[model samples]
Target: MRMGFTGMTLDRADHLRRDEQALKLARMHPSARFLLLDGLKPVLAPDADRLLWVRRSQAPDNPSIFLGLDEEGIPHFALAGAAADVGGIATDARAAGTRLSAPEAGIVALARSLLDWHDRHGFCAACGAPTRPVKGGYGRQCDRCTAQHFPRVDPVVIMLAEKDGLALVGRQPGFPAGFFSALAGFVEPGESLEEAVARELWEEAGVRARSVRYVASQPWPFPSSLMIGALATADSHALSPDFEELEEARWVSREECAAALRGDGDWSAPPPLAIAHWLLRAWVEGQVPPS
Candidate 1:
């Protein structure tokens, strides 16, 4: 199952950074566009299809982050400003569905992540001095220490544990009854993807995974995170919930998992855009080892 926000819309022209003429053309070109990003939300214009795109002057006066060039060779930028600055609707990036083109949606995610990084990193991490954006919003330079800082993406491991033709899915305390998805946790320092998968499964559900395999990955830019999807063979099926991360876990058959994915079963599952849905479907389709 292909997921949204997987495609790259911009060419990310790094060579033009030091080229004044090329940079000016990219900024002053009539074909260039700037998307307004307020914090993590994007300014969107509602259409009959509800696609999210708002046109502004080629050169915006506000401090803008230079996004990459589109396939047509048009430069794109993102400006962090108020929603009222434009007549369009300011909405969350998640609303970009069929209403918005896939490339546009992917760009929105990139804009949100970049703008959010700049928002929270106004000060130097090394010295306490104030920092200014450089490299077209890619990094910040500290005035006092002259240190350069770049944005970061957090990695999270979301996995499905399968054993004896059954999948282990669990939910937290506040989830709707019978609503369960893949177990996930942030990757700690010095931890590998397979190690994080096994550790998270054990800590959340008390399930020990003997072997883990890489499945797929997705960029979940809700404040910037890379979701690493994995599948593992369960070594034990002891029922124990951490109560903080999960309440209880159950082993559901592949047939029941299929019904849940179709939204016709007793329980509900994650949506197609979420990597968890793909991981579950892969297990049901026998793409993962089921011992």
Candidate 2:
């Protein structure tokens, strides 16, 4: 499957070394440079502003976090505090019609997730004491118990189920009218990717699936989630959507999916930036099973 526009490919050849060196450098220099992220968007420090400064309340440890580098090898940093608010910044960016490149979007997602994690994990669960930033903001150290905490990325399973000549699609309650995509859910603690796919399919659409195969994965940093894509086989053609989870569900034909992709149908497919769009495209192109 093809990656979405916002997908990022950063060459972190020297990042590991840089992260190790930054700590010693930060302690020596009291006023060190920091990057600011308004959600997943980076706050660029140009000529006038050499260092990004954000409100202390937003990101208390702004100077300490490690914002990953871009494809151009520029290190981006997360601005703590109100700068982490995504919806507000996204609306502003949209209103200004500030078009973002794929790499820029990826940076924004990364920044937002990193800062959010720090905000929520100010105290250690092991000792209930204040924690300090460590490892270029990748980890935290508990003052009371010496417990270490690391940033977490939740895994989500998104799959396209097919059998015969029809593919399964479903619409969640909050989706735009007539919008339907592949079924997806978070992976439980003990479940493998395939098990998660099978479980989600049966729970949401009442379909039993077999031959679950892994596809491409995407870093969906809506608070840090890794989208695991897969293709599954459904043994039945029945439409039994669990209304509690989905507003509607059906078995759509490959031609119908193709029409939706082409914007020639009553229902439209997801935007190109979403993994769902790629999954459907792969199915329509016969890269996956026809159904």
Query: Candidate 1 lDDT, tens digit per residue, 1-291?
Result: 247667666798887654656776777777778787665677776544332334456324777777887779887788876666666677767776324666766777788888889889999999889999788788888989999999999999999888877889988888888788989999999999999999998888888896788888888888899999888899876768798888877888999999999999978898777788888888888886443
Which candidate leads in lDDT? 1
Q: What is the TM-score of each candidate against the true structure?
A: 0.92, 0.80
User: How many collisions per candidate?
Assistant: 1, 9
Cα RMSD, model 2: 5.2
Per-residue lDDT of model 2, residues 107-161, tens digit only: 5556667777887899998978999877777788897888999989999999988
Q: List where candidate 1 sits over 4 angstroms from the true fold.
A: 17-21, 48-60, 97-99, 289-291
Q: Cα deviation of 30 in candidate 2 (Å)? A: 14
As a TM-score, model 2 comes out at 0.80
Error of 2 at 217 (Å): 0.8
Residue 265 of model 1 has an lDDT of 90
